[model samples]
Target chain A: MRNMLLLAQFEVKKMLFNPRGVIALAAFSLVWLLILLYPIRGASEFLISPDYKALIEGLFGPEVVSELFKWSVAELAIYWIAALYLFPLFSIFIAADQFSSDKARGTFRFLTLRASRESIFFGRFIGHMTIQTILVSLTVLATIVLAVSREATLLMPAIGSGALVIVNLVIVLLPYTALMAILSLYANSARQATIYAILIWAAMSITIAIINNYLPIISELKWILPGSQISLMINTQGLGSFAYAPVALLQTLVLLLLGRIYIKRSAI
Target chain B: MRLIECKDLSKSYGSKQALKQVDLTLDAGAPIALVGPNGAGKTTLFSLLCGYITPTTGEVSLLGHKPGDAALLGRVASLPQDATLDPNFDILTQLILFGTLQGFSKKEAKSEALRVLSLVDLAGSASQKPKSLSHGMAKRVAIAQSLIGSPEIVLLDEPTAGLDPANAKKIRELVRELSSKTTFIISSHNLDELEKLCGQVLYLELGQLTQSVSMDDSQQSQYLTLTMQQCDSEKLLNGVMELADISSIEKKQHNEFLIKHNSEEDYAIESALFTLFKQNSWQYKAILKGRTLEDKLFS
Candidate 1:
């Protein structure tokens, strides 16, 4: 327990001190600011015109705006969809350097002195999770504040959406974190791990889309992907639904198990 | 009791074996020097002792416990060859973190960190980040971190690699002072410094232990350079040779004769040689000589 705490403190210190972490937070804030400043006013018009409303209504049901609003805030469906790409990219960027950076800087030796390999691995994972959770939570809070301030009528809807977005983001981040931790342990270089992470993210995204269109039998496989599960949860207007909760939970467990195994078996 | 013991330890990276069937033992209170060239397996040996890397086919024990075991880790401190501090953290923070890992509570870690930073002469730079410090200062901070919990055994790998002479002298003095209560295994290419600090030495060559010698044996040679009248040279040399204690004599030049004595009998032989010079009415200019550990180590 002491070793784990020490290592976690060190990991947090590493992240806080990294210049890229500051940059990432700044980038996220800027994106949130832009979204709040410019609302997607013509989004419905471009995607579904009044003529197609009848067709859209048949598929989506009569209360389209109410359903859209509920889905948007209840599950943070739109934001979760966007985070599919954003969260994985963030995970790859934040965690790709966990082990490789330490190895490159020669800090692994220093870390090993205080803690065992197991403590180091799990400590770093927990620290990254904490940082991710805090960042996403802050972003949600900021967006809600901005949206409510812009129009009082959007307050409850914004608050609801923000809460769901945070939950979905946490779910989406878990597998990416696990995958990146594994990459950090397995890869010799940070660049190689990063490249591989990005490639895998892209491949998985494309594969999910293809499977969703062509193979109905294995379409459920899409829900197993880290970002896809969150996207489904967000679009379904059910934050506590079994469709999203059980699958995300299971995926998280599997990724974490595999990550721990890889780290334990690794050479350094 | 032995502070460290390794029996027929071996380790390999892929097809390249870094450490062969090596056996070593370190006692509780003696400071040992590990001297070796690059790739001589010095770091590998330290790693094995620290449990950073497991041995492929042997057993290593620290304080009678297996290496890397929780008990061993709690009692052992190591200053790795290329170990780096977190660039983002200040010196004090790093020290405190390492101390906590070594079983100190937060308050205890803070106080111990302060004490260790002072030992390494890094107390003033406690707030500076590692990236802001010079290479030597950073190395000193790393050393400070290892001394945190005051473990029973401290393994320092090239502890003075980047320090200037003055800093190196300070570190050597600190090690000397600490060795009374702490067992130290210091690895370095600096023979003279090692000689000054270590009571025992382990020399490695090509991943093998070539020699292990005690400092007492290394200090046995007594070579004296006597500057006297050219006429008295022959008489002095004869007097030195006649003494049973004199092992060998080498004539370096017209006036200088290198004298060797058996063990610590140099004082007796020197007194005799002076008596002979006094009887012969020899006029000597000056006599300058001392024991050189480097000579023993290299030769």
Candidate 2:
């Protein structure tokens, strides 16, 4: 357990201190700031306008707009929605090189000499998760600060909703980061791992669509995919937003186990 | 203590057999050399010992534990051939991380890293990134990591392959100095280096790993090599052959000969040869005590 934590700390240092890691963090910050600026800060008036409210209701129906408005503040709702999608994609990028480049350079040979392969694999997974968590929390805090500036009365409520948003976003990112963990084992570079992820996601979507069309009996298989619960998450509110937590957790568990198996059998 | 033990070990990759069924044992003592040609099983055996890969068949043990066991993490370490340090990290941080994983405290790990760096004469480069250093320096840093925690056994694959002679000699000196308290299994193609350092040699070829042979008795040689300073080849050969108990003499070069003789006739053979040389007024360059590792392995 101690060795595992030590290895995880090393991974965090790599992501935070390395030149490549600094560039990645910078890119994430710039894009995240733009997202916060345009959607929440710049469009606040349009979002709360009467006609826009009507437009949303007319487009999706009263249920989604009512569910969206159920949040403590308007900005928090926008931040929650944007974050659910943004963080997962960012996670795929940040965690793509978790093991691939290390394996290529033979650093794992050095690591495995002092730590077990399982420890190295899981420690890196935890490290990437920790990084994504920090990123998500910072963005959520920024949105909350924005909410407080618009309405001081909403601070307590915004904090509550911000906490919930952080939880939901973290759960959503679990499977995505775990997917990259398994992919890193097979790829020789981060680019190859990212490409493999896109290919897998595309191939699975097409396969699921074909199955749903031809074999309607097995349409339930779509839920097995990593992001399949996002559509359901869109209309849920409060604790209901956690409805898909079990599914995300299951996907993460399965991918992590498979990754552990691969690392054990590999020659690195 | 036993350093390594393998019984009928074999390893295969799909259809290719990298190591055949072989049994071997090594005990704690002087350094051991792993020598073989390219495509030999030298690296494969090193991997098996370090538990980087599992054997396809048979059993292997290090410090009385199975290879790759958690119990052996700090007890065994290796410098795998051509493996590099992660270029993204500075040398000290990587070494400290290795030390912590081996069960040292953070403070202890730092000091240990510095100590090993000094051992390799690389203390000043600790804060520099691996890419900024030359290949030889980087190789020395890699060797330093293998020294962390003062492991009971270290497997070095091509430890000095790319190093300049001076740097290579420093590493050789380091290994020699450390061998008193640690067991080293070094794999390399440099026979002269291996001959100077290793007390035992394990020859691997075509997936077959043989039993360990003493460096002094690699060929069980009762032969000696003689180098002379410009002597008449005919007179030298004839004079040496007339000595009692001398088995055979072959001229290896213009002034050198390989002489094989009875194992029991040590003093008599040498005294007679010296008397022959003195009579012919022959000036000698060197009289090697035993056949070279090259002769033992190839001759």
Candidate 3:
């Protein structure tokens, strides 16, 4: 436990303090800030609009669509979709260098001398998750503050929705971070690792689409891909929100184990 | 005591065998020099001993425990050759992290790192990023980290390979000072420096252990090399021919003689030859006892 925490501490410091980390965060914050300031600010005006209501209803279905007419529900729904889609995409770039950069520079040579291979891999995985949690939480809090400021009665639901979004975002991040960590083991450079991660995702998504069209029964093979449960996670409300939680957790553990095994078996 | 025991230890990467089966035991305190050519399994052996890679056939036990055992955390340290520092962290930050990993508290780790940085004469460079430092500076920092917590055994592969003369000398001096408490297995192509620092020599050739002898035995040889500026092959041989301590003298080259002494103490023989050379007004370079490591290993 101590070893894991120490490695995690070092990993966290590296992410927040390094120049590359700072640049990535600054860029993400700029784009995230624009979304929060522009579209999120107009949620109250849009919730009262009848045409937007039909459109929201058409997209999300009548079950959750009526809830979208409320300001808190609309902000949560928009942010949930953003978190489902955009956050995982952002996670890949942010996590691209997590393990590969260290392996490339031979830093793991020093680390393995003290910490076990499992500690290093899991510690890095948890550290990346912590950062993503903080990012998602910040955006969720911003959404809640905007909703409560408009209609104070929406505070409780906004808080409830905010928590769900945070959980969903973190679940979405688990497999993506673990996938990048695995790629880092084989990729020669951080840039190559990032590009390879994107290529793998594209390839898997394409394969899943083709399978879905030809053989819908076997389309469940899509679960093999990381973050394949994001749609199920976002579309389901309350009890259904956690439907794919176990699968995401399973994929995270499996990828993390594979990464640890690779580092252990290979020569440092 | 950190005792290193290897029993038929072998390693192969698929079809290519790196280290053949070998057995050996080494005790702590003496500085052992690992002398080998390129592709001679020097780095491979270090990796196995440091637990960077596992052996294929046998085992390596350090301090009576397997390498990389949690029990050996602060007891064993290594300076891997060609391994660069992380470019992001400053030297102090990374070194302190290493120190802490060995079980030191944060404050204690910082203090240990500062002390080691001073030992390597890089006390002022602690705040410098690894990429900002010179190659030699980076190597010294690597050495400094290995010295953390006064490890019982240190495996240094080419510790002074690329350092400047002054820095190299400092490293040699530091190793010499630490030889009393630390068991160091240093692998380097610099035989002369290795000879000066190591009390024992272990030679590897073609992934096999060819020679293992004490440096003391290397110095106790009957042969001595003499270099004189105005030395004549015949004259120098004649000059020491009748000396009781001298058995025979052969001219290796101009101004050089390989003296075979008559079982006399090395200094007595060298003293007699020095007196003879002084009488003949023969200017000389140096009279070194025994063949150098290069001559013994390579020749």
Candidate 4:
């Protein structure tokens, strides 16, 4: 267990210390700033205005207005809306090279000399998850800060919901990270791994839709893709958001198991 | 103690069989040499021993544990041919990580990394990334990583392949210094180097273990090379043959002869050869016991 943690710690160091990793982090920070400036910061006042209530009713219908009003802090609401989809997409890129480049460079041969392939695989998986967790925490903390700066009394409430938001967002990104673990095993590069993820996602959706069209009984097969729970997950608020956690957990479990099996049989 | 055991070990890539069914047992000892021509399955066998790839058939046991088993984590280390360290991290960081993984604390790992880097004469380059180092330097760093924790069994594939003469000699000296405590299985094409470093040789040909020889065994070390001053080759061979206990004689050059004899004493053959040289008025240049490793393996 100690060895596995050391491997995980080194994996994090590898991603952060590499020039490419620093560049990726810089790009993410730039995009995040743009998000904070335009949609999140710009729309903050509008979320509390009467006009905003009407716009929500017009766009999402009157029924959603009541459900949306539960979110008193505008920054947290907007952050959640943006983060639900943004994080999982960014995760694919962040985790895509978990194994591919290392395997290609033959570094695993050095690592596996002291660690097992299983430990290295899961150690890297844990490392990617830890990185995603930090990114999520930073963005969430930013949202919470923005919320409290505008209305000091919203501090306690924002902190309460921000913690919940972090947990749910991490759960949603788990399968995406795990999916990369599986793709990285076969991909020769991170770019190739991302391409494989996109191809597999599109193919999976198309194949399921085509199959479901002829056989309606198999409509539930849509859950096989990692993103199947995102749509449902985005609609829930507060404690209700925990409902789809099982689906994401199941997907992560299955994908990680598949990755482990494939890695065990693979040549380093 | 038996250090390595292989039973019906075989490996194939699709339709091409890289290693056929072969059984081998290696005991704990000084360094052993794994020698073969290209496409002779030397790397494949090394990979199996290191547990980088599973064998298609049979089993491999290293230090009483299956290759790649967690039990053998700190016990067995290997320098796989062409395998490299991560280019992103500096040499010390990677080496320290390897040490910590093998159960060293951070402080201990750092010191161990430094020790091994010094062993390869790259302790000063510990802070430099792999890309900054030349190929030979990077290769030595890779070798240094394998030496971390002073493993009981170290398998090096082509340890001196890219090294210059000075660096190669240093590595040979390092192996000699460490051989008393660590068992090394070095696979290389340099016969002369192996002949100096190894006590046993595992010779493979076309995926088969054709011969497993001791460097000091009678058949390999019993012959002598006689270099005489310019003389008639037939006359030189005839005079050498006239000596008793002469098993065979081959005229290697116009004035050189390789004589294989069944004599129990090397001095007895030398004394007789000295008399034969005087009878033919051939002044001797040099007499060397045993043939070159190249001659032993190929000739």
DockQ scores for all the models shown? 0.52, 0.86, 0.66, 0.82
Candidate 2 lDDT over B257-287, as tens digits, reads 8888875855666777788878888888988
Best by DockQ: 2
Tens-digit lDDT track of model 3 for A133-242: 87888888988887778778888888886787688678878898999888877887878988998899899999999999999999899998998887666556543567
Pairs of colliding residues, candidate 4: none
- C-alpha lDDT of candidate 2 relative to the true structure: 0.87
> What does each candidate score in C-alpha RMSD?
4.6, 1.9, 2.6, 2.0
Question: What TM-score would you report for chain A in candidate 2?
Answer: 0.96
Between prediction 1 and prediction 4, which has the larger TM-score? 4
Clashing pairs in 3: none
Worst 10 residues of 4 chain A by lDDT: A63-72
TM-score of chain B of 1: 0.83
Correct interface contacts retained, every candidate:
0.53, 0.89, 0.67, 0.88
List TM-score per model, in order.
Answer: 0.83, 0.96, 0.92, 0.95
Candidate 1 clashing pairs, residues 3+ apart or interchain: A73-A161, A77-A234
Is candidate 1 or 3 superior in DockQ?
3
Tell me the tens digit of each residue's lDDT in model 4 across B210-229. Answer: 88878887664569988877
